[model samples]
Target: MLIDVAIEKVKGLISFFEGYRETGFLEALQIAKEIALEMNIDATFRKRRKIKRKKQFDENPDDTNIAPQSAQESFRVNYFIRVVDQAISSLTRRFEQYEGYQKIFGFLFTSETLRSLDKDSLKSSCVNLEASLTKDKQSDIDANELFVELKSLQNFMPKENIGPVEILNFLKRHDCFPNASIAYRVLLTIPVTVALAERSFSKLKLLKSYMRTTMTQQRLNDLATIALESEVLEKIDYEDIIEDFISKNTARMRMFK
Candidate 1:
């Protein structure tokens, strides 16, 4: 159920972005802020309810584990309230850092404005993009020329075709605008959740059971990696792997012969 809620929240964020793709960054930011506000309100309500229930639970000493109904209700309320609090905290942190994201990816997200941006606006965006880059990456390209190339590409490309992937493909195809491509690549690599890490820990528990308590960390990591990527591993040809193994080792070849 928590996963479902998380998925729904992601979906909401995607939908919000999609709807505001052609609009400017300000519009998108407003939508996001509204969504976050709604979530905050819901979280505040849940927190208050949790506090009231906790107070009730504390006030009646006899009610503490005396009745399964009261105890179960308390546990359920506490666990759910914790989940809500976590979700709220995550959203709040994202909101706090939103301005930086807007500065970096704002132009990429606003497809409609890309082609129409005048020299001053494009220059400002270029400065913002360069400011966001690391010192090593910052020195490697001319932001002004990259902005010129971006404007030229935007002139030829349809507004609808202007997106992160489309722009990336355009840059790669033309071998132009290295800085812009790198910025987009950085944006693409940013993770939205810790679900993958959580899954890894879960896999670790399964692989390193009580009986396997003495397993080395290196061996456990290898096993967990294999387990996590089993879908990809399943597609590999084990027969080919065995043949290659035999070809690489004289002992294996002799044994097989």
Candidate 2:
């Protein structure tokens, strides 16, 4: 989708340049400058209007002095644009952390990198990983050892079967290349979204309402974990749990026997 938008933007720019060329340089410059100035003025007006509308809404949130639907529609469009802009800005900021990780992962999984397994390419991957971990001050691994392990692993594993899990398993099986394995593990642990955290919060709310206000943190965590992994829980045999429960109590064990 981003590619499509970029293509269209490029096409628009081409058309713009062609039109300007046909109209002569000086005329085109004047026209372009005027358009830019007008756009800047319009943007300023829109910003002011948005602020004014927000202030009005804050003053009277009850919809008592609601504007006409046509006016409201314009406000909605402005509101939507503001929201989208803010959301994109927030997402871009969050993605900055993963940008280095992305480059490292790309290098790790690439056919060329795997086939070559040279010191230079491996060093570049290490640099990319280190940049991603800028918050941490120390680089713990031996670079030469990591390179050797990567080359050995690449030779052992087929290109067709290479993936995140496969690479992790290969590292585990060999029990070498602690640094490279740690990097892969860290990459695997990175959350793709906040949805899981949000879901846990939602579950907490449901589990520890006013009735259950005295629940301990440990118990709440246990319950929440169970709630989240309900699919796994569903597969368990309740009869086995019952037997285990009975065995834990001597009286119940005697009764069952």
Candidate 3:
């Protein structure tokens, strides 16, 4: 995913939540009233028992006629505004990592972005990438080697109608550009969301049931893989598999043929 684009989306959501916080009270009240109307009931807050306490040492005891909050005011202050504030705060906190992600991987976002970089900028990007990935004196790729390889790679790749996916495919076929391959592999394998991981966990609940108590770990893993990857399994040619299964010997091959 494009880091800048993702960051913009997160910002947009926060802005929307802020706008809601400012002007959403009356609208929320209206919706509550409408729901109450549909149910043939009054939209009202339950009255609390009035309590009296000693005034503060500096306070006037004569001032005791505090107006109780109306249901609209109570709900607005207690629920609507608080919920919207939480939404804004949570959004800001959750997506803050996107900015750091952009800094590390922004230059490799697209084919056009990569191709447009001048040599000096590209070299700087490689150096920065090396720094980000370096740990305990080990590095994924040599920055200078990656710089030279990418410069040579740009000359032969198509100017349009391509992105990192296509570039990775090229690397796969030729097995050249080791540094570029590592970089692109890391770039492409970044998890955009946790939905797939969540789904795998969900699948485990269904796959390892009471009846499957005795299943071996390896067999369970294989079953989970096949069950989760049913889309890929659907596209496989069953006839080819059947033929291959049958042709295990000369007699079997002759019979199948």
RMSD of each: 14.0, 14.3, 3.4
lDDT of 1: 0.65
Compose the digit string of candidate 2's lDDT tens values, residues 169-234: 777887767877876676566665578789988898899999998999899989998999999999
Between candidates 1 and 3, the lDDT winner:
3
**Greater-lDDT candidate between 1 and 2:** 1
Model 3's number of clashes is 0
The lDDT per prediction is 0.65, 0.63, 0.83
Q: Which candidate tops TM-score?
A: 3
* Candidate 1 off by > 4 Å: 1-86, 136-141, 197-257
lDDT of 3 by residue, 1-257 (tens): 54556688888999988998988777877898899999999787777777678678887656666677876688778988889999888888757777777777777776677788899999999999999889999999999999998888777677784767888898788777999999989877776667878999999999999998999999999999999999999999999998888877788888867
Q: Kindly report which residue pairs in candidate 2 clash with one another.
A: none
Best by lDDT: 3
Q: In model 1, where is the ten-residue run with the lowest total lDDT?
A: 43-52
Clashes of 1: 0
lDDT of 1 by residue, 1-257 (tens): 12223445655655554444334344534565688798874322222232324446347676555533454345335754455456556665655455456556667653565776787888888777776674955454457876877777677666574556666776777675777677667655554467777998889889999999899989988999899999999999999988998999899899999
TM-score of each: 0.48, 0.51, 0.79
